[model samples]
Target: MADLTGSDLTAAKAQDDVAAPPSAPRRGGAAGLVRWDTAVGALLAVLLLCSFGFVGDFGNTLNLSFLIGNTLPMAVIALPMTMLVAAGEIDLSVGSVAGLSGAVMGSLWNAGMAIETIIPLCLLLGLVCGLVNGLLVTRLGLPSLAVTIGTMAAYRGIAQIVLGANSVTDFPQQYLDFGSGRIPGTFLPYAAIPWAVLAVIAVLVLHATGVGRSLFAVGASAEAAWFAGIRVKRLRLSMFAATGVVSALTGVFWVLHYASARYDNATGLELSVIAAVLLGGVDFDGGKGTLGGAIGGVFLLGTLENTMSLVDVSAQSQTVVTGVLLVVSVLGPRAGRQLARTVARRRSAGSGSAPAATG
Candidate 1:
């Protein structure tokens, strides 16, 4: 009878253990901001609803199309910039790279080179520009921020040299139409189709692949990632290159969309991209962000700017608004995290102080 009783107790214990769920990962630092990302999405939805009701013609098709079209240049660049930041790096030169690519497109067109040939060459230039930035940072062990700042100036100067105050406005009508047209009876710009495809590719790469895991790992701790056999430098280099290539592509699109190519295209685009990424809850320090959140941030800013424009807000006031949001993005998460920790501590203390149940 005793042996049977012991066996029964042991079996019950084993069953209870098996029934327990596995422990979930504790949120830490920026990693805890996953909830924050969702909050931004919700806020964006609310803002859109309010705008449609309060702002005149904001719901109309033409205004909506302009909003998406103007926002796209920054939005597309934000995609790769998110990944680069995820891996704990940034490329300020992206705007200049866009400008340089456009300048080259203009120069080649002026030389009577076929548009087809010039495009491929422009893409190749992007790869080369990216490689140069990657090499400087990876090979020389320089800080990426400093290196990119230098390159930003150099690239823009080269753009000036290439196009020399001239703009190229003539391109094949078909290509121009693709850049600036919209689908019938919808708010979707034709350029948005390609951007949507790229967004999907980016989402898959960041959220569902080994490469994505490695980026978070590196951003969280470069030394640890290296110890775990990740090719840290190689990965960083590739990310820089990706930023370059995408920015270059955006430049080409910029030229066609505006029907002109010049040295100064997308001059301050990096600011918008970085601002949107951070506002999306991507930790500026790295190791935490979602592409979904980043994209949400993009549209939020775009919408706000569009509404402001419709309301006759001065350009300087809009700049101030963006600056204020930038400040909030940096501080909001840290404050929320602190408040959460305090609440958790209070709960723990209250539970500990509770009296035991009567026997």
Candidate 2:
């Protein structure tokens, strides 16, 4: 056998590293799809049972429709938010973007443009807003958190200025029904159909495709992904833009659902989105979450809210509950990961010392 040189060993190690799959939680191919996120989803099911068992009228078709309908917008935004977080970025400006898009939509509709025209324009404006955030982050090399915070305020301020304490509530009834209406004989809202399609797409993109795998790489370590030939900056920019577009679309849906358009629409929604995403097991720091978990987080919060309202729990207490969940979501995974590493280190030490004793 030929002797292996140090350079050959180094090259072999590098190759092995390159060939290794991403260390993020897997959803397919022998991973069996059960994970921490699955546990959260199961919790959602438990909450539903409790609601049915205890809360009066909680299982009624009308209330269920309203509950799911109200949550549709947040659920829609959560899809793109998952991808962005997985790619190691965040868009705090989404709520503001949604508000601004709604404001623009109302203004244009009130100015006598066709709703069709107004909708497309509003979507384009959302793309522009997202692109601006992307440019500032990727081109200026700014931190996404700081950049998005600034844009969040800017977008909301612009929305306020554009609509200025006025609301447009004269939308057509057909459109309104589409936003908030339920399917015949069922609690499932019409909005759910679109959200379902989007969810499936998000799952495929995040779990079944090369782009999804690349996002895991980028989130785990951008520098390493870049060295491995991924276009980290471009990928992140695309994520921000997609977030903007989806958020704006949700804004349109919100106006229709409520049959009201106000600059303050979707106010404080970013917190809920973040809380649900993180609570579902997507790490706030990026690179370790699943779409299933994120979706479950959204439903868990929704179910909790429904149950509280049914049992006459005050909104103030509900807010506290949300805050606690948010805190726990971030801390829980981190604590678990730390404990896991500690156990692993101990096992390694024990194995090595056993060999020493045998020698």
Candidate 3:
């Protein structure tokens, strides 16, 4: 063989290293599952324990059913909210949209429209609301935060205008039964079943599809994505539409469950949905979260609220708790970043000192 020169030796070594670098250790089954949002899980476990200790009958499945029933609508809305956030947008109008959709459906039903017409009409309304949001943000170049804030007020106002203080209660028995009904004589709520199914579908779409990956990419870096030929505007619009549609679905479910539709339906729910998404490990800055984590966040919030309610905690205090959690969730990542920097500094110092020690 010919004598190896310095450059040739360097190149050979680089190629070999690239071919045979050490593999990172893999987490095993249970540990792997817990790795996604260990913090959320810990909070949930502690809440569960406290709930059992403080509330009589909290251990029963019926209590769980009640919690599930209440939380299902929020969960459904949050799924699409997760996608919107992942795509670097937010929809503050979801609560109002949900309310409006329910009001519309109720009004139509009270007027004797068939269920078929009401359902499609509700879905179409969602699509329209979402499209408007998308237009304001994407076409007009308005900030989504501002646009959604305006729409939140506008939509809720529309809901009030539509129903005033009066409520629509003459829903068909089939809807009422399905909405408030449990699953086939079990304590499992029917409302929760649809939400669960929707959550699974949303998760699969967000995690297992190309569109999902692209949404994340756009959120992570919109300019970069645009340069890479992704249609950032269209995707953002679609996500907003999806959020509206999901919120509408939840609204319909609400009408079914309560047997009444009112302007106040799902009021102030936007915060809870966003809280669940953030607590689930989706960064507020965008482009990082899992559907499973969002679901976990929903469960965490649901448990906290249910436990609090059982103990007679005031709604105001619960809001405070959610606000605190939101702050902590955002801060936790910052704390981690600070800790990483500290560790990196120490490691650098150690490596520098190592040279002297060897010398």
Per-model CA lDDT versus the true structure: 0.88, 0.86, 0.82
- Please give each candidate's TM-score: 0.87, 0.90, 0.86
lDDT of 2 by residue, 203-304 (tens): 999999989999999999999999999999999889889999999999999999988899999999999999999988897777888999999999999889
Candidate 2: clashing residue pairs, number: 0
lDDT per residue, candidate 1, 1-359, as tens digits?
Answer: 67765655555445434432221112324435457679789889999999999998899999999999999998999999999999888899999999999999999999999999999899889888998999999999998999999999999999999999999998989989988899998989999988999999999999999999999999999999999999999999999999999999999999999999999999999998999999998988889999999999999999999999899998889899898998999888877666555545444444433322211
Show where candidate 1 strays beyond 4 Å.
1-34, 342-359
Report the lDDT of model 1 for residue 318.
86
Descending-lDDT candidate ranking:
1, 2, 3
Query: Candidate 3 residues 2-90, lDDT tens each?
Result: 34355444544454344322211111223223444776778788888988886897888778788888888888898999898888889
**Cα displacement (Å) at residue 274, model 3:** 0.5
* Model 1 error, position 272 (Å): 0.5
